[model samples]
Structures are given as C-alpha cells and as structure tokens.
Target chain A: MTLRIYIPCDAAAVSVGADEVADAIRTEISKRKLDATIVRNGTRGMLWLEPLVEIEEAGKRIGFGPIGIEDVPSLFETAAHPKALGDIAEIPYFKSQQRVTFARCGITDPLSVHDYEKLGGLAGLKKAIALTSADIVKMVTDSGLRGRGGAGFPTGIKWNTVAGTTAAQKYIVCNADEGDSGTFADRMLMEGDPFLLIEGMAIAGLAVGATKGFIYIRSEYPHAFAQMNRAIEIAYTKKILGANVLGSGKTFDLETRLGAGAYICGEETSLLESLEGRRGQVRAKPPLPALQGLFGKPTVINNVLSFAAVPTILAEGSAYYQEFGIGRSRGTMPIQLAGNIKQGGLIERAFGFSLKEIIEVYGGGTYTGRPVRAVQVGGPLGAYWPTHLFDTPFGYEEFAAKGGMIGHGGIVVFDDSVDLARQARFAMEFCAIESCGKCTPCRIGSTRGMETIDKIIKGEDVANNIELVRDLSEVMRDGSLCALGGLTPMPVLSALDHFPEDFTPAHQAAAE
Target chain B: MSQLPRKPTQKTEAGAYDLELVREIAASMKGLDGPLIPILHALNDRFGYVDDTAIPVVANVLNLSRAEVHGVVSFYHDFRHEPAKRHVLKICRAEACQSMGAEKLFAEVAAALGDSAQVTLEPVYCLGNCALSPSAMIDGKLYGRVSKEKALAEVRK
Candidate 1:
C-alpha cells in the first residue's frame, strides 16, 4: 500500500516555496524507497501554514505544515512530529469555514477527473443537463446567489435578463480579471478547483442559451492560466465541455483570454473590449451588457465566484444554498483575510459575521501584535472602518449603510501605526494610474485629489485642504463614469471620517 | 499556418531586428481572435521589451496600424520599452502589504538598491500574497515576508 501525500500547487503556496517542499518529500521518499504517491492539491486557504502537507492515515488526513525540506523525514517516520496537526478537518480554521464554492479545493487533485468525481464534482452539471433553461435560471434565482464580484448584483437576475433577450449569438463571459489588491479567491478557485468553474460556466451557458464562453484572466496569474488551460483540455477530453457535454448533445465550450495588466479590465464592458483586442476602456450604460454585450449580442457576464457557485446551487438544490446567510446576501463569501493579520487566509462564511469576529477571532489579530487601528473590508476602493465600527455585520448592505462595502470580501487589516492620510492619497494615486481616461472626474480628479491629500499631509492649508479633498471626492463619486471613479472616494472619505488625527501633522480638527 | 506577410529588407537603424522571429511569434497565433496582445507579450518575453521595429511588423501581420500597436505598448505599465535591468524587484505597494511594514521595507530596499546597476526597483499594487505581507518578486519569482537583506541578496545575486 502506498502512502498518499497532498501538497498544494496554489500560486500563493508556490510563492512561499511549496514546490521546494514537494521536491524534498519526493527525494526523501525515493531515498528510502518508500511506497508513496505525492498529489499536488489546491490550497486549503490556511495560507499562513502553506506548503501544508497532509498524509492519509486511517481514513482521515493528518496535516503537517509551514513545512520545510528538513521536516519531511520525520513526517514519514511518525504522526507525532512537531509540526503534526491531527486530522486536518478538525483544525479550527478548516472546521469553521462554510466552503460552498471552495469545498473541493485542497481536498482533490485539480487535474484528476477521478478525484473530482469521488468528491461529487460533476453532480451540478449532471443535474443541470437534465433541467430546462428556464428551470436552471429559476433555480439560480431561487438560490438568492449574487455576483461575488464587487458589485454584488443578483446573478440569476443577470442570467434571466440574458435568457429573455433574443440574439443571434449570445455569450457567457467570466470576469477572471481579479485585479483587486488583497483578493485572490478567483485565482484560488481557478487554480485549485478548475473543474468546478468549468461546470459552473457550462451550467450558465445552458441557463442563458449561450453556445460559447470566455474567461478573461489577468496575465499576472500565469499559474492559473496554465492550470485552467490544462483543465479545459481535460474537461473537453472527458466530454464535460465540447460539442456533446456528457453526451447531452448540447454544444458549449470556452477558452481563456489573458488581460494585459489593466486594472480597469476587471469591469465587464472593459473586459469585453479587451477580449475583442482593443484598449480596455469603459463603455456607456444603456444597452446594458445583459441586452447587448460582447460583439453586440446578449451576454451573461459574471465573476468567477458567481459562476463557480452555480454548480453547488444546481447540485444541492437552491433551498440548500438559500438556507445560509442573512438579508439578501445569500450563500457563502470566500473572504480573503490579508495584510498585517497574524492568521491570514481564506474564510468562506455565511454573510452575517461581524468585522471584529472576522478580524480578531479568525484572523488572530495583527502580525505586529499592535492594536488594530482600522480594517479595509474590500479592495483599494473599499472604505477603512475604524475599530469602533467593528461590530458592523459582513452583509453587503450592512457594510454599505456604515460607509463601507464588502467588495469581493477582501479584508486587509492595518495596525495603529498606519497613516490614514497616506492611504487616502494612495487610493487617488491608484485611480489616477489605472483609470481608463474615459471620464474627467476619475481622470483629473484623482490626480487633483492626490495633490489635496499631499497638502493635507504636509499641514499646508490644513482646514481648507480637508474640505477641498472632501468636495473633490464628492464630485468624483457623483460625476464619474463607473465604479472606478465612483467608489474611489469610499476609502478616501472613510479614512478622512474615521482617522482625522492622521490627516495632518498639526492634529487639530477644522472649525467647521 | 499560413505564412505571415514579412519583408526581410524591413530593417531598423539599430540593425538588431529579427523579422523572422517577429513574424514567427505573430504567425504562431494566426487563428486567435485577437493575437495582438499575446504576440506583444511573446515578443516582449523573447526580446525583454517590445522593440519599435517589431511593432510595425506585429501591426502589419495583425492588419493594425503601427500607431495602434504602439498605443497598446505604451498603455500598459508592465510592457517596458527597453530591456529591464538584470533584476526586477516588484515590491507590493498595496494596503495589505503596507499593513505589514511593506512601506518601510520598500524604503529600505530602494535605499539598498540605490546606484546598483543590476537591480531595478518597481512598485506593484498587489501580488495576491497579502497573508504573507511585505512580499517581493525578484527576477519573476515571488518571495514573501521579504526583509531588506533577503531582497538585496536576491537582487544582487
């Protein structure tokens, strides 16, 4: 009998030397002439303990991690090694997660169809194949699933719109251009559970009557690109994709397109433009993407998570998914806890957990051991909530009501030593650099906002500059073309509102 | 694949042009709906940067104008016009990395790489390794929890 060892091939895991650890394990196994099969699995999302090795013992997997090459020999010897964590599933981090989208990640060989089937991978697609297009759309709608992409738009609503539209050539486009800082859920899913996304996309194609689909992934994720391409090829070979999907006689297939480092390409219209081989620029509203998109046809554009969640919705039944979460934000959110946090990783939870619980309990506080000053719930566009507001729930509207958004469910914590003024300036600077240059408010206002923030930081005309910066943010919010300019003010305003002490060196509030 | 329309006589003043290589790069992606970006990336990867001479060749092959190709080349910050230094150190400048002393680390790294011809320091928004902050990519490989000493050693080596 061969001992099965699982090591993550996830990009984040690889970044922190998972490959070296895997090589060391293989070398040691060969040196001892041990009967062992090393399987490269996706990350379990406990990133802090990556190169996380697991060995199947007595029908349960025992984990060992933050593992170096030196730890391998002893790992093979006994289960009582210093890094040994008994029964990987029992670990609190893995135990607590409500992993609907990421259920298969870190548990199965991403490229292996056999492993995927054993873990119930194709159940959703199998179910989807039996249902009518309207029934599939209704199932998704009843599930209460929304876009996991920043906007949180209802996924089924978007599908319904596209389904109703009659077009010669409809398209299903997956926005894999996850350019947001501190967000990697999409990348993780694509790399780890590649088949899940394929199944989800296929289901979406069936629901919306789209024959073809395209996943627009950023060029930065080379590992994901390779993994998805290989997965697509495998899915085709297995008839999960291609002309006759699982012998259903339905023609549905897709390909991955790489985006050239433009942050704006994360926007659906801009992503479509980039796919068509042009400069990524934002298009005007009216003739919404659902009615007319991607080569002037009705298109169903969704984030990677939104599509990935479809399989679960179809397989388990919509009511099973709708049971989780509070308010309208249904299902689970794969929150990427990052930055200065001690225990940073992915936490997929029902959408009602408070900010404090996520930060202190799950994240285990700051890595620096300093008092957490603020936490940004979303990407660069998300607001910085002060510690006093840590009780706010993680729902979409809950965060929004308190001048914050759970945009893409990425929470990046900052310690007390952080300069809020500098962060505000960075938001403006990032917008300036990444703006599509389609609108004046985002294009020029961002540059001007930076200058205002610099003036505020320098303690030059402190009171007036504060007001000016606020006014500029308001203009950018109301006047901008899309969320890029509109939402850029969230972080800026949140910082200015929460940490006024950091706005100036002088440290005095305006008389206003 | 059908042969790309290329002229060997089309040479730049630098005379370092590889028309066959340019055409081959573009020709390989002949059937792709939009081969422009991939061709540019391939050329850039091979040549270190997209040369001006190759732009016209790419444009010609893709049936696009040289100006349009140049627009794309210049639009992206990742696509450099000249060959990069011996080592490219991309430090994460986003909030997550900054939360873990990345800003201070970036300063230290910059100061260490000062006047060092072998290293080029660049600021990237994120590398998606926020859990392991103060991350850096040296010569395309990522190193998390990067200390000034480790970054300097990697860049200098």
Candidate 2:
C-alpha cells in the first residue's frame, strides 16, 4: 500500500516556506525510497502551524508544521517528530470553529473536480438542477446568508432581483477582489477548494436567469487566479460547467478576470466599470447593479463568500444553516485573524461569538507578547475597538451598533505599543489614495481629514481639530455616493471615540 | 502615507515599444467582452509594464480613445509605466502589516536597495496573506514574517 503525505500549497503556507518544505519532503522520499505520494492541499486555517504536513496512517491523518527543511528527515523516521501533532482535526484551534464555507479546504486537491465531488461537492448545484429557479432563489433567501464582503447586504435579495429582471445576457459576477488587508477566506477557498466556487457560481447562474459568470480577482493573487482558472478548465471538461451543465440543458459558463490593484474595484459598480475596460469609478444608486449592471444588463454580483455560502445553503437545507447563526447574519463567517497575533489564521463560526473570546481563544493575543491595545475589526475602514468593547458579538447589527463593522470578517490585532492616532491618520490617507474620486467626501474630504488628524497629532489646536474631524466624518458618512466615501469615517471616529487619551499632548510627548 | 505615488504623464517615447507584439497581443484579446482591461494586462505581463506606447496600440485594437486606454493604465497601481528592475519587492503596508512593524521593515528595505535599479521596493496595501503578518513578495513569491535579511537575500538574487 502507498502511504499518502499532505502538504499545503496555500499562499499563506507558501509565504512561510511550505513550498521549500514540500521540495525537501520529496527529496527525502526519493532518497529513502519510501512508498509515499504527496498531496498538496490548502491550509486548515491554522496559519501559525503552516507548512503543516499531514501523513495518513490507518485512516487518520497526523499533522506536523512550522516545518523547516531539517524537519523533513524526522517526519519520515517517525510520526513522533518534535513538531508532530496528532490528527489535525483534533487540534483545539482547528476543531473549535464550525466551517461551512471552508469545509473542503485543506482536505482535497483544489484542481481535482473528482476530489471535490467525493467530499460532498456539487450537491447544492445538483440539487438546484432539480429544483425550480424560484425555489432555488427562495432557498437562498430563506438561508439568511448576507454578503461577507464587509457590506452585509442580503445575497438572496440581490439574486431575486436579478431573477425577476428580463435581459438577453445577465451575468453572475463573483467579487473575488478580496482587497481587505486582514482577509484571505476568498483566496483560500479559490486556491484550496476551487471547484466549490465554480459550483457556487454555477448555482447562482441557475438561480438567476444569467448564463455567464465572471470572477474578478485582484492581480496580487496570482496563485489563486491560476488555480481558479485551472479549476474552471477542469470544470468545463467534467461537464460541471459549459453550454450544458450536468446534462440539465442549463447553460452557465465561467471566466476569471484580474484587477490591477484598484481597491475601489471591490465595489460592485466600480467592478462592473473595470470589467467593462474603463476607469473604475463608482456608479450612482437607484440604478443598482441588480437592475442595470455589467454592460447595462441585470447582474447578480456577490462576494466569493456570499456565493460559496449558497452551495451549503442548498445542500444542507436553509433551516440547518439558518439555525446556526444569531440574528439576521445567519450561517458561518470565515473570520480572518491577522496581524500582531501569536496564532493568526482563519476561524469560521456561526455569527454570535464575542470579539474578546475569539481574540484570546483563537488569536492567542499579540505576537510581540505584549498586552493587546486595539483591534481593528473589518478592514482599513473598520472601527478600532478598545479592549473594553471586545464583548461585542460578531454579527452585522451588533458590530454596527457598537460603531464598528465585521468588514469581510477581518480582525487585525494590535499590541500596547500601537498609537491609535496614527492609525486614524492612515485611515484618511488610505481613503484618499484608494477613493474612486466620484464623491467629494471620500476624495477631497479624505485629504482634509488627514490634515485635521495631523493637526490633532501635532497638539496644535487639538480640541478644535477634533471637533473639525467629527464634522468631516458626519458629512462623509451621510453625503458620499457609495460606501467607499460613506464609511471612511468609521476608523477615524472610532479612534477618537474610544481612545481619546491617545490624541493628548502628554501622550504624544510620552510616545516621542 | 505622505507621498501619493507618481502617476504616468502623457509624454511618450513611441519608438521604444515593440509595436508588432503589442498589436498581436491586443488583436488576440479584443474578441473577449470588455477587451481593453484584458489587453492592457496582457501587455503589462509581456512587457512588465504598460506605457503611452502600448496604450495607442490597445486603444486602436479595441477602437477606444487613447485617453481611455491611458486612464485605465494610470488608474491601477499594478500597471507599471516603466519596466520594473530585475526584481520588485512589495511590502504589505496595510493595517495588519503595519501593526507587525512592516513600516520599519519597509524603511530598512528601501535604505538597503537605494539607487540600485537591480531592485525596486513598492508598498502593496495587502497580499491577503495576513496570517503571516509583515509579509513581502519578491518577484511574485510571498515570504511571511519577513525580516531585512530574508527580503534582501530574496530580491538581490
């Protein structure tokens, strides 16, 4: 019998020398003449243990990780190597979270459609093939899966609108432009379980009346782009995608498009603009993408996670998925724990866990071994939460009520050494740089916001400057055309509201 | 955060580009829906950057205006106007990377690679490898928990 060895090809894992480790393992296997085959899979979301190698023994896969080249020889000698972990699934970090979207990651070959189907893949699309389009839309609408790409818009409602619209060529646009700093769920899914994205997109096309789909990924994610494209090619060959999907006479073909480092392109309208080969400026509302999107046709544009959630919603039934999460933010969220943290990785759970519990239990606090100072929930535009407000539950309304957001479900941890005032300044700076310039509050106001924050930092008219910032933030929040301009104030105001002492002259003096 | 990266001006040295190759690539991709963005990206990949020279070629193939082509090349941060050095090192400068001393590390990298066209250091907001904070990508391969020595060795080679 041939022994099977598993190593991750995940981008995060590769960042920490997984590729090198994989090479070393191959050399050792050949040199030792062992009966072994290597299976390069994705991360188990235990990023701290990356370069994680798993060896299957009697139907149990033993794990070892943070592996150096030297560790390879020992892995062959015995499963008792110093880095050896008993079954990876048994690890507290891996076992704790309820993985719905990322269920097949780190388990099967990403490019293999057969491996995907063997692991309960295509069940949703297969189920959808048998149902009425309205029933499929009704199933998703009943599942309560909101957009996981920062904006918590209802996914089912977006689909329903497109389903109702009449168009000759409607499109299902998969927003794989995962631009947020502290997120990688979409990347992981695309690279690890590419077929799931394919199935999800296919189901989406069948749900709506759309026959074509496009996945717009950021250019920075070269690996994911390549992997998704390959998976799509295999999907076409397997008859999972093409002119006839699953021999059901339904037509849903897929293509992957790359974005050239424009953060604003993550916005649906801007994405549509970029997809049309134009400057990625935000288009106005009242003509939402659902009604007039992508070459002026009805389109169902959704985030990678939003579409990924559909397969499971259809497979497990809406009631099963809906029962797990709290409030309206149903199903599971693949929460990314990034930055200044000891155990940084992905944690997917039903949307009700407190922020404090996640940080301590999953994150293991700051990497520098210092006390945690602040945690910026969501991306750059998200509010920076002080430790006191850490009890806020991980839900859309819960976070919004606390002046924060679960944007793309990214929570970046910061240590005691961090200064919140500088973070506030960067928020404005980021908005200024990435803003599409379609709105005043996001474009010009960001520069002004930066100047005001700089004045506050300099201890020159700190009181008045703070007042001025608050005024600017209100305008940006209410008056901007899109969320880019509208939400730029979240980080700025959160820093001011929570850590007022950080802006004081004495605090500046102490830091300097 | 202070200096907005410089954008490409309208001036062009037209004779420098491989016009035939640009036409071939543009013509090959123009059949796709919204072919302009794809054409610019292909040109960028083939030439390592897009510039005023290739813009006219792409615009002509897609039958769009020169301004339309240039607007796209300028709009995106990834579409470089000049040929990158032997290597390009992108340090993650977003909040996650910043919290993990990426700014200081970036400063160190910039200083080490000064005046050397052999390598160029650019700040990317995020590479989506946040689990490994303070990450850097040199020549399209990502390295986690990057230090000055690792970054310098990777890019210099």
Which one wins on TM-score? 2
Which pairs in model 2 have colliding backbones?
A150-A408
Name the 10 consecutive residues with the lowest summed lDDT in model 2 chain A.
A73-82
lDDT of 1 at A71: 86
The lDDT of each candidate is 0.87, 0.88
lDDT of 1 by residue, A1-512 (tens): 88999999998888888999999999998999989999999999999898899999788998998898888888878747999888999999889989899999999999999999898899999999999999999999999998999999999999999999888789999999888888989999999999999999999999989988888888777778889888988898899988898999998888888777889999889888877777888889877999989988899999999999999999999999999999998998999999989989999999899889988899999999999999988899999999999998789888889999998988999988788888999999999999999999999999999998988877788889999999999999999989999999999999999988888666523311
Give the fraction of reference interface contacts each candidate recovers: 0.58, 0.82
Model 2: how far residue B132 lies from native, Å: 0.6
Could you give candidate 1's per-residue lDDT for residues B121-149 as a string of tens digits? 98887777888888888876877888889
**CAPRI docking class of candidate 1:** acceptable
Per-residue lDDT of A125 in model 2 = 94
Superposed Cα deviation of residue A380, candidate 1 (Å): 0.1
What's every prediction's RMSD, in angstroms?
Answer: 3.8, 4.4
Compute the lDDT of residue A248 as modeled in candidate 2.
95
Candidate 2 docking classification: acceptable
Native-vs-model 2 lDDT?
Answer: 0.88
lDDT of 1 at A133: 95
TM-score of each: 0.96, 0.97
